[model samples]
Target: MTSPIQQPSRRAVLRMVAGAPLLLGASAALAVATSAPALAAQAGWRWCERCSGLWYSLNGTRGTCPAGNVFDGGHHSNGSGNYILKTVEDGGRGQGNWRWCGACQGLWYGGNPTLGYCPNRGATGHTPIGPYPTISSYYLIEDVGNRDSPGGQEQWRWCYKCAGMFFDGNTPGGSGRCPKDGYTHSVTGGSYVLRQVP
Candidate 1:
């Protein structure tokens, strides 16, 4: 005759029931992380102390700056902080159409039908750094208007005069120098935040 099957002990049943919630929670966390959009970030973008404009510093040649230079008339990065820029390919959580200008090495908006003003290009407009279709378009996250991102530096704005991104975080109510304008860069758009690359 076959023996009857034994039932699990009361203690064993209680242990599994207690651990069920923990296992489920872990699975939920993993799912959320995997479903999130991927963010690609590049460091070496920096603020220009002289012109107060944002520029890419990874290149060997420093592009022209609106503010004249002592040596080569290029962008002066003295005491400037290195910033990290993120590109979300899926159009996630930020403003798009931001592009790197090869002509001046400054970041400018590329969405306009007419190319915006470029100090280096002399009214021709800023040139995108890379070739067509392969050019990198960046997404800038606004740090203003109820979006408080404490991890990045705030008060960075788009210059209406130059159509280039510039820093307005100076003391005593002074905006950084503008290349297009003889004086400071005029802020008109959203306040953007850029994380300093440590």
Candidate 2:
């Protein structure tokens, strides 16, 4: 008679089979991590956006964005239809929050036309040119020659609710009601003095 044959335990066999997939997954993850540097090297440029500012780096050499945000793999839109993968030099003017004045075809600063005047029009006042967050704060001041003032520049108003700058043009003349917030004080009388940017 043959000696009793040895057999593997059922539990042991199951454990081995289950562990195979886990081992394979771990190996695959390791491979991807190891290849990441190579992929980054192949990348031509990278960009990062932060509350403080936008930044860029070449060939993956740049560090993380401010506040420890990771740099994205590609370029980002400047909200002006242009894809930017690098920081733009704006002389010493710094980045400006500007709005387009359609009537004058120029730009005004700080969203309030009354606070400042158009580039070419002196302090004639501003009209609601378009939506906020224009493409670029920088605009070419067009010489539209001399034309009648649009006559509806929003008066500088302060909203107690939003604590943001409100324009009188949004409401009827002499009314202090904010569009987003109910009645507030008009900071510029019914009108405001225009200060042009140099």
Question: What is the Cα-based lDDT of residue 98 in candidate 2?
Answer: 40
Model 2 lDDT per residue over 1-198, tens place:
010112222333444656765555667545544431112111122112221112222222332221232334222313211111111112121223443343323223444435343222334543333343333232111112211122212233333232223334332333332222233432532332111211
What TM-score would each prediction reach against the true structure?
0.73, 0.19
Q: Over the stretch 1-198, how does candidate 1's per-residue lDDT look in tens digits? A: 010112232333445656666555666655534442222355678888778889888767578888865577888788988786665443456777888887788898777775677777877888875433346677787765533234668888988777889888787545877766578888886788777756
Note the clash tally of each candidate. Answer: 1, 1
Every candidate's lDDT: 0.69, 0.28
Model 2 ranges with Cα > 4 A deviation: 1-96, 100-155, 158-160, 163-173, 185-198
RMSD of 2: 26.5
Error of 2 at 153 (Å): 8.2
User: What TM-score does model 1 achieve against the real structure?
Assistant: 0.73
Q: How accurate is candidate 2 locally (lDDT)?
A: 0.28
